[model samples]
Target: MDNIAGTKSSLVWAVNIAVVVLVLLWTIPTFGLLVSSFRDRDQIATTGWWSSLFPHEASLRFRIGDAETQRQEGEVFVIDGSVFEAGGTVSAFGTSNRDPAAHEPGEVVDFGDGISGTVNEDGSYRVTSPVAFEGRSPRLFVTSVTPPRFTLENYDRVLFAQGLGRAFLNTMTVTIPATVIPILVAAFAAYALAWMEFPGRSLLIASVVGLLVVPLQLALIPLLQLHNAIGIGKDYLGIWLAHSAFGLPLAIYLLRNYMVGLPREIIESARVDGATDFQIFLKIILPLSFPALASFAIFQFLWTWNDLLIATVFLGNTQDQLVMTGVLRELLGSRGGDWEILAASAFVSISVPLVVFFAMQKYLVRGLLAGSVK
Candidate 1:
């Protein structure tokens, strides 16, 4: 009964649960990054994004009004102001540096000789003394619970102030050309390999398949030397060419596999209708091959967008020419302690890839699975 041809398996629920867990494992961190990106630097430093929704308790030190601001209120000299004007509830406070939360909110602390101070729950504080104050204001330590805070300042600081905006544009410039050029070149080559007969077609296909296993690292130095020899060194053009060259083999292989699986009858019918090979490829093959194209586009886009090594080797890491990844690396080294900025920058970096993946994911399986069975 369990093995019945049309019946569902008991493990279907297990598979679903596994998939849900995997989705959560991936999604939760990305969601946290998004939440952290919007949070204040101080909040991100002290607490995790999960605790961002509720009030947060922190011990903070602030200085009361200076003696210059003290005035006579009948017989007593008083200094009145707020410890936290930005809005928070002070649950506990103290006048001494040693014991910050010595008394509950609204309870008075006596220093000496009629000098007294009290802090209210709303962060206001009043200090009174029989004699006038003379010098610096006393320091007040407080335990406060503040509402969750979110801000765009992290994004603002990274994007505009830290040069990520320029790097973003530079990355787009590198990635778009890199992705598109290879796909165009590989589509033509793949068409030739799949549909058009040639003397060395078998060897060519075999070579492409063989190239897939070759590590990009092996070719980096040779390719860089070649580029320098050809006078295309350390520029956008060089990186674009490098990415396109590195990506071409896989693109050709994938597109060839998909194009080979296309119906023979359609090609024959087009030929019978007196359509030339070029016309058939343009009019019939491209439309039919959209899934494969989209799949390769997603791959190439993701690789080029996230790439650091190729960009570094091909495009010199000048401040003006650095890609997003390079700029991010700089930030990591320079602002390693600034969690909020890193969170925002990381989210910014992954956002485009996420959009590209979700937009084209429906075709990914179709493209990769093309010709696998038939």
Candidate 2:
């Protein structure tokens, strides 16, 4: 008994260590992405996400004032404000994103005809006028020290500005129905396959398994045309049917395997008790097959949540019908530089799957153990 206990302890320790390592490997980068998603766009580009927890200093430059805005406040015709601050290094300055770092910051790099700003150690710079130099505009240069940035701007941008909350609601609508419909249909089919006696059953099951191998990509255009012919194109019902059809094959296969593993005696006794096929299925088969159902629900929820290709193809990517994938794709086009927005968007998209997994994982184990002993 002592030896057995020692062996079990060793196995548990090994399993725990493995689980810990795997979790960390998966979570560290995800956490980094989460932090990056909350940072300023420029800050995101400059430093690693882990460095966000500590203070950071970066250099930048700005024009003191427009040429027209400049007034004779003093005899020197002074440019009073400082462009750059003390903490960050101002290595360069430029007028545009393309020329953003053209002149090295803090070097007091000379512009022709005495038009230049000297960045001070305190982060302020003063540009002096020639006293006779006249132009329609003042040439802009900038320097600055920015503190470490953390912002909720990404959440605001994605959730409100980009209408991602609406997309999220749309996704939930599509995902819930898409997941439920197939499982309902597949459960019936799987019960019939496992428990009903009918001719050509093996052949029918074989046909479904075969359909699993057929690439969904090949069917996209044909399906769209089919939906359009049937007057269901570019609508919620069409996309739901599309998702259900795509999810059905695997769902039936899994449930059928699990149901067939159930003891024949229980089903036989239920029938002997004068329970009809429908009653037996509802009372005996369903209650026992829950683990399998829960397991499949988890898979369906995750797949539907993350589906970019099918949602885009079936739903017609309109603003009203647009799901999370469509929204994320739009964000990539419009605000690709915003890491915080991307991170928050990704987190929102995945939140449901994580919750479902945690809630239902126990059923997966219970379902797999089903019929094992019998």
Predictions in order: lDDT: 0.87, 0.76
Number of clashes in every candidate structure? 0, 16
Model 2, 1-374: lDDT tens digits are: 55554567777799899999999999998788878878877678778887778765444435455666555646545565655433454445654445666665455645556665565545555666667346643454444445566788777877887788999999998999998989879988999999998999999899888886789899899999998998998888988898899889878888898899899999999899899998998898889988788878777788898898888988867778999988888878987877777888987877777787677778655644541432
Summarize candidate 1's per-residue lDDT along 261-372 as a digit string, tens digits: 8999999999999999989988998899888998888888999999988988888777678988888888899999898989889878888998877888877666556524
Please name the candidate that would achieve the greatest lDDT relative to the true structure.
1
- All candidates: CA RMSD in angstroms? 3.4, 7.0
Candidate 2 C-alpha error for residue 196, in Å? 1.7
Off by over 4 Å in 1: 1-24, 61-63, 94-104, 107-112, 134-141, 368-374
Give residue 141's lDDT in candidate 2 (0 to 100): 43
Which candidate comes out best when scored by TM-score? 1
- The whole-model C-alpha lDDT of candidate 2 against the native structure comes to 0.76
